[model samples]
Target chain A: MNQIDLGMVDWARAQFALTAMYHWIFVPLTLGLSFLCAFYESLYVRTGKEAWKKIAKFWMTLFGINFAIGVATGIILEFEFGTNWSNYSWMVGDIFGAPLAVEGIVAFFLEATFFAVMFFGWNRVSKGFHLFSTWMVAIGSNLSALWILVANGWMQHPVGMIFNPDTARFEMQNFWEVLFSPVAIAKFTHTTSSSFIVGSLFVITVASWYLLKGRNTEMAKKSILVAAVFGLLSTAYAGLTGDESAYVNASTQPMKLAAYEGLYNGKAKADLVAIGILKGQKAPDDDTDPFLFDIKIPGLLSLLANRDAGSFVPGIKDLVYGNAQEKIVGVKAKMERGRMAVADLAAYKNARKSGDKAGSAMALQKFGVNQDYLGYGYFSQPEESIPPVKLTFYSFHLMVTLGCLFTLFFVVFLYLAYKNSLERHRGLLRLGVVSFFLGLLASQAGWVVAEAGRQPWVIQNYLPVHIGTSNIAAGNVQATFFMFLGLFTLLLLAEVKIMLKQINIGPEEV
Target chain B: MPGYSQNNIFFKWQRTVVRFYLDGFRAMTVGKALWKIILIKLFVMFAILKLFFFSDYLHTNFSTDQQRSDHVLEQITLQSKIQAVEDKK
Candidate 1:
């Protein structure tokens, strides 16, 4: 099978991504709302005011709904690792299994056990105990983020372990290094803060919408103010953490960074294209070739790469193939010949196997004639595969669009919050809806770019994606796919309906 | 509590069976769903079963011995040949 088939991996990745994205709609809210709930609770404790209690209770109700959705969505992700990417699981099980186990035992258990008390045992428990439970829930959520990030971080940087060829796994060599890899830290901070930003914007916008609609003024005021504070902090931190994330990416996966920036030429002073197509003659045609006309960031690439503010970063072309002067020009030609020979052999074999005598003769004739041309197909000593440049180019654009929009939306929201006009500005409230959807878009685009950019490699260089299948029959995957697809679709529809119903009803009923 | 020494074997087995069904039903029905914990327990049980029956099949199938390794390489080569023919157009 070709590397980029929209087959089992595609189906599985799409299914898993769908479920995760659906569930993600709730997770950031759970993280963001839980803190808002706690903050309201703290305010209640200090002021001994009934309004604080009302505010806390209102958001807490919303948090409970979100937390339930998050919990449901999260379960699928855990089981999916073993089911969809079984090879990846077995290969990384030695190193990866630890964090997943810890997440379950330490973070998940802590969250779940206390969440029960916080959600339902308010009357049975003391106020202090209940408050403590809420705080525990917050800690539990963040801790969950921590462990998951640690797992993902390893994928990006692949450190703190030694590859064991015997078992084909990476055995954990240093616990501390695994925990504190630069990529892991940068990713974790950036991811969690981004979630917070998403959460804050979500709450504030909804609250502002309510106020604009004349639904609940006091509720809207408190909600908007609290969410605005968190939103501002998260937005500002996202920029800072994003910078760190970029730096880590530049160091760890330079190719990914290059792809994201559309730096096909890999010039030392790589230009960041504001926009461009990655098709036809636009993309780098050969490793030694330069990209076609493109927009660029003067020296932003160098500044982002080294933080030295002046050092030039190599473009994608340069990264994939070294300087043009260093290239072996005739390599591809040789590679082409080997490929064409194989093709001719295959056609001849197919004709013979099918018992088509005339076809066999014709195929042999074609093979004899094309023998000289085979060299063109296989001249390259080591053939360099480019990403589906169009896909990468478009996915990169989608991600950048969302990023820029998010930056603008949050900046505007923050300014409005500072002006104390969040409740009054209908325009800003509308922007919230736009920003929330944009967050979803950004996350999906990010995944597409990252996964697609890694086109041939399931684990970078060592393993190919096609060879890493589960050995289960394709029928098995098909059967399971239909079953889970139905279930996930039902769950997703129900979740959205329920969430909307809760939002419309408001906390007064509870 | 049911005392072990005095009970008949049938009664003991009946109680164990009853408790098993009850625990399973509770896990399915409980509101504060401890489904994950239950799922893990179930996974371990399945793993034990696999160890007994499926482990040998797995070892034989995926083992990277020379013969299997050669077969895989041949398969990949064949597949690539087909791909090249397709790409020609």
Candidate 2:
């Protein structure tokens, strides 16, 4: 009710985004590299070859460098939830906290315990036990991802929670529903699989570097063989799960789906923008063309969204203004209903204090009817409902395009490696070395789409971000943002330096 | 007697595992660098940033859970009340 500090909210959002993006750089590598280490170790055990052991140990060392540096970055995010977004924390902490707590208490401990054994148990324990420890670390790290993604998934598509007006919180109605929500499962699979691609790329790139230098050629070849196969399979799974994500987006967050396609108007058959350049910014209701130059696959958007070429797909303008024939509720109407819900909630509280049972019941019922639109009440205009179209569109397109390229990159590398001609293709190996950075880019782009697309809402359709922010000064958040930037940059440099030094030393030294 | 023997064997195994880790860590080459990074990063994150910069607003300001909950509840409900008054005007 008091003029909300837009500056504070924006800074808080920026700070959270900065932390999350930096944290993501380390996470996917950990997720994917752990399994690759396990696979390499498994081969070592099977073959009883010192070369295989060396290769496995080499990758594991890199994984350790990454894992150690990445360890505490996530704790800052948790701190931010309580510091900058305390209101949002209180609102959904009951539901959101559950998954995060599980991740820490179960998955983190599992990973930490085995991680020591995996690193140091080579001579101390039996080969079987060491291999098992490696596999456990792999599983434990992914399980950690699973729980965090589940928490994030709940935010994008909130379900299995009942709003308790008495406590002013959303409490979990069913833990299973929260954990196994379709969005959560899709998110978990897509995220972890793509991470595997990043991990594979990292290994391939380092190995390619070795090949280029004409040093450790056998180990290089062996690393490429394992990584290329793993990368290719992961690429396929990431692609499949990515499609599933789009499908899920269409139903759960239509605005995001529309933004991904750069769709402006509703149509029975929408074309997917295969490649396009946006004509700068335009108002949601403007008559100007959205794109400058473009190529599109006919009816692909409709098919992707609704699983039918002929099925109608709504766009950004339609989402904001409403589509009559499509039976879509506009943000304006939702805002009115949301305002009514808010007022009714206040009135219900007042009535209860006055011991007016009848009045309280009436207000409570009205609130229930309009509760789904509660977040919309915070918006001052309908256009505020639309996420930043250009950012979302470009991020989505970049992720998709890079994904296609990664698939091709993997196939070619895999073929060359199998034929033992990878060494001969100098250019491809050079490209392979560069592809790791592209893989990181694609991974970041995916998060941009997921988080940026769901703008203004901390919890979809329930709480807007402005209200979610803590009543803190904008200056405080800005100062901390710079602090984090410096800290994360230092850590990133440390990680890169350590990893490079290890790579240069080669597996023979290990 | 069997359970006691099993427990003794388990303790022996645990001690060996602990010793294994201690010796391995002591003998580490690249791992020394990793441990340094971890310790420094943890100190920065927990000791400096958390201790000084970030604090749980509700917990720091409010002593009791009831007060915290009440404050949050008021924040959620108060905005609507103001909007209602504006609409009436």
Evaluate model 1 with DockQ and give the value.
Answer: 0.08
**Residue A420 lDDT in candidate 1:** 66
**Tens digits of per-residue lDDT for model 1, A1-510:** 333232665566565666566656667667767777888888887788878777787777667656654554565565555555555666677787788788888765778668766766545567788788888988788888888778777776677786542243568999789889998898778777777766776677667667777787677777767776777777678778777876777877666676667665554444566766544654454553333556667777777777765665655555544455634233244345546554664566667668888886776676565443332332222324344555666786786666666666656766776676776677777776566667666655655666566554455443345444444444545655565566556555655666667667776765
Highest lDDT model number: 2
Query: What are the per-residue Cα lDDT tens digits for candidate 2 across A439-499?
Result: 9999999999999999967899998787787778899999999999999999999989988
Worst lDDT window (10 residues) for model 2 chain A?
A1-10
User: In the order shown, what is each candidate's alpha-carbon RMSD?
Assistant: 10.4, 2.7
lDDT minimum window of 10 residues, candidate 1 chain B: B49-58
Which regions of candidate 1 deviate over 4 angstroms? A1-6, A275-283, A286-295, A324-385, A388-397, A414-420, B1-89
Q: Which stretches of candidate 2 lie over 4 Å from their true place?
A: B1-7, B80-89
